[model samples]
Target: MDGSQGRKTRQVVAAIAAGGKVGRQKDLLACGHSEWSLRQAVKAGMIMRIAPGYYALPDADPLDLHLARHQARKTCFSKAAELGLWILNPVPQPHVAAAHGRPVPGCKVHRVKGGQTLMDILRQCVGCGSELEALAVLESAVVLKQCTVHELRTAFSRRGDGAARAVIAMIDPQSQSIVETAARYLLKKVGYNVQGQASVWGVGHLDLLVEGILGVELDGEKYHNTPEGWAEDLRRDNLLVINGVWKLRIPAAVVLYNPDLMLLWVERALDRIETASPR
Candidate 1:
């Protein structure tokens, strides 16, 4: 590939992997080729046209990710590359990834600066959180930490692709479990009564609720990845029913990407309750 094209391809890739940088010199050096080749591909449209030598996958949505990450210069001291660092080296400042080019001056580039609110967490995170977490607060702001899952979910849908996904992961139906906690500050503005986690004889504590009516559960998918976990979820569901709490399980994927499905499911569940009542 020619120099310009190759550069664009490299840039696109760097863009998609936000907060992640791809080294042109290292990549081409390993392949016995020059970084200039990445530029060639960019011109040919063989790869995404990023800043210079960076490349995002052709199909990767540039709009979904922050295009600016490709503009930052890379630093070798990043914690992930360290041989034996423990505690995950608390997220890098702004958690911004470096790009190949003249550094943009006066830009405060910190890795994972603010992406998440403190509420997503059931409790304070142990050790530290991921760059994605810090980004939550950055993208949404401290006020988002105040809204209910329903309110936040609405706000999250308007974000671009990757950012939208990131925002939703921070809050899920589990908003029900912690709704009251949020309502103490934010939900009250919407005039909704927030309920805290409710424990049943057989079921564990549910995430959050409203007027003791709707139940919401946020699923991170860690449990579904294993067979034992899948079985446990089924068992848990049965226990939930025994305790008279019907929950809407919101998966991280649906919550982040296809959140409307979650809203639909919640609506349907609520409809069932309304239908049973003699109004």
Candidate 2:
């Protein structure tokens, strides 16, 4: 490619990369690339025409190409998962947001304007999923500092967002992971006063403190499988016992999948603590 042609190619490449490695023909044209330049670039294998109006790098993500073809962007659970949020259940198909376009086959479509924000995704999540699922995503965003509780509450304060606002009220940013959020939500729903990341004198922060006595620690194997992690947890458990705090250590999976069993255990432990203490 000559100097002028090379500059044009670089411009097109930069445009596509800027658009998450996928650009529409009109977008490239708006970026000062002519039809002749685009055609030449495609012919020279500089960029691939994934769809009629879409141009992407040859190795662009298939999902991006698919979304580009349908003029949609990820939203709801799909976008939540993409943003590394805590997703309790995985959807079978991608969920996308689009204002006006033919629905992408095998994908959930949420009618939303172009250039949707993280708040938009959260609003869509609240509208689309169950309360628990929505809470998980919201808590994930808050804990990650992606958004704030105030921002969310304000965003959902509009008319017709009563349900979304209700879900936003349930967000606990202190719940570190999805498992902790689920456990806390379940406990709260059953009328337990659940406190997340409650600090004890010696134990620092417990995953949850129910009724001010029972320390429920949700342990994911990823963090506890190592010998050092196991020893540290044991040390914390010992400190809790010394401080008159009863500890209930449950696997993260139990909180996610077998919540009933976890609840039963909690009830039983609380009962034991109550029975043993002189009321």
Give the best candidate by TM-score: 2
TM-score for all models, in order of appearance = 0.37, 0.91
Task: Output the worst ten-in-a-row residue range by lDDT, candidate 1.
Answer: 79-88
lDDT per residue for candidate 2 within 1-279, as digits (tens), equals 899998888788878888778888876787788988888789889899877888899888888888978887678899889889889999988998877856888898888865768888888888788999999998899999998999988888889999888888888767788899999999999999999999998679999999998999999999999999999998998898789899899999899899999999999999999999986
User: What are the root-mean-square deviations of the candidates from the true structure over C-alphas?
Assistant: 14.4, 2.2
Off by over 4 Å in 2: 3-8, 27-37
Cα lDDT tens digits, model 1, 52-141, are 544555565433133343454312122222212112123434222332333434332333322223332211121134433333332233
Q: Give per-candidate clash totals.
A: 55, 0
lDDT of model 2, residue 266: 100
